[model samples]
Target: MRIYAHRGASKDAPENTLKAFCLAFSQHADGIEFDVYQHENGIIVFHDRTLRRRANAEGYLLETPWSTLQTLDIGDGERIPTLNETLGVVPTNKWCNIEIKHLVDVKRWVNDVKAALSQSQIAIEHVLVSSFNHHWLKAITDLWPEVKIGALSASYELDCTASAKALNAYSVNIALDAVDKTFVQTVLSEGFNVYVYTVDEPKDMEMLAQWGVTGIFTNVPELAKRVMAKRASAKDAVSDKS
Candidate 1:
């Protein structure tokens, strides 16, 4: 299973900052996952409806211009990065999962995201676009059909698999709490990749791997890497016996 850092090794550094992202890569994560929002200045990397929780600032990201938002230091002297800057951090071999956190405008966001990806000069396949707003994903599909998209759902009732198919999503990014053997099998049987989010526990990671999850989003990339290494070694030993 591939391991993606949730907001870039968020457990170690401030979430969604360049430091966190660089730390994620150093910690051996296969990919980096971060949230993005389109504002007047540009597409900026951030999560949450407001900046209060992480940045200790008071303002709606949607209403705030990038200049004003960028001035607020998230942590360790890291300002919020633009989508272009964030994309620059991803190596060609690694994947970048950009989650659309808010929809100021679906069409406009898709255009800006596409532009940023184009500017990054990375292989288009290396980036996976995901969003809880299926509508926005659908718009992305219509506009940038070649880009891989994932349908994100925290609720099992949302029928992520079906919705993913409808949106032409390459994968379904579901909440870890809703994942199980049955759920993973159900989605896999439909020929869609399954990726669960924010997994931090070793037992849970092992279980998800056993359930055939394609990837996991985690806060502790180093820990997940260590756990996966052990899992791989154990599997190899079993195979050798066979």
Candidate 2:
């Protein structure tokens, strides 16, 4: 399974900061997942509509100009990074999952992101855009047919197969708590990759791997790597004995 650093090895570094992203890469995560919202000037990396969590400043992000927003120290003097800035710094081989946080301006954000990535010469295959907003995913797929999309869900109210068919999503990201072998089978049966989020426990990672998940978004990529390596070694030993 692919290990994607959730908000860039967020357990060690300030979430959504470039420091976090760089740290994730250093830890050998296959991918990095970061949240994005449209600012007045462009797309910026941040999860909240307000500055309450990461910054000293207070206001809705959309109301604040990019210049003013960039000045605030998210934590440890890490300024909020633009999508372009983050992509530019990250290695081309590493996958980037850009989760769109704003549902209202999803189309605009997708267009801007595509434009920024193209200008930066980053391959589209290296990126997967996702959102909990189904409409946003639909709109994006409609506009850019080739870009891979993932349906984000924290609940099981919607059937995975139906959702994937509806959105034409390459994958589905479900809450870690909601996953099991049956659910994994259901997703895989439909030819869609299943990725679970925010998994930090070693046992849970092992269980998910056994269930045949395609990827995991985690706050601790280093730990995930260690656990996966141990599992691989055990499997190899079993094969040798047989």
Least accurate 10 contiguous residues by lDDT in model 1: 155-164
> Which pairs clash inside model 1?
none
Off by over 4 Å in 2: 103-107, 119-121
Question: Against the hidden reference, what TM-scores do the models get?
Answer: 0.95, 0.95
Task: Tell me the tens digit of each residue's lDDT in model 2 across 1-242.
Answer: 89999999899999998899889989999989999887768888999989987896788888888888878999988999999888876787779898988756656776788778876645888788888888888998998888888989988755657878898889989998777788889899989999999899999999999999999999999999999999999999999999
Against the true structure, candidate 2 has what lDDT? Answer: 0.87
Candidate 1 lDDT over 61-130, as tens digits, reads 7878766887888888899999888888877688889998767677787777778777774788888999
Instruction: Estimate the Cα RMSD of every predicted model relative to the unseen true structure.
Output: 1.5, 1.4
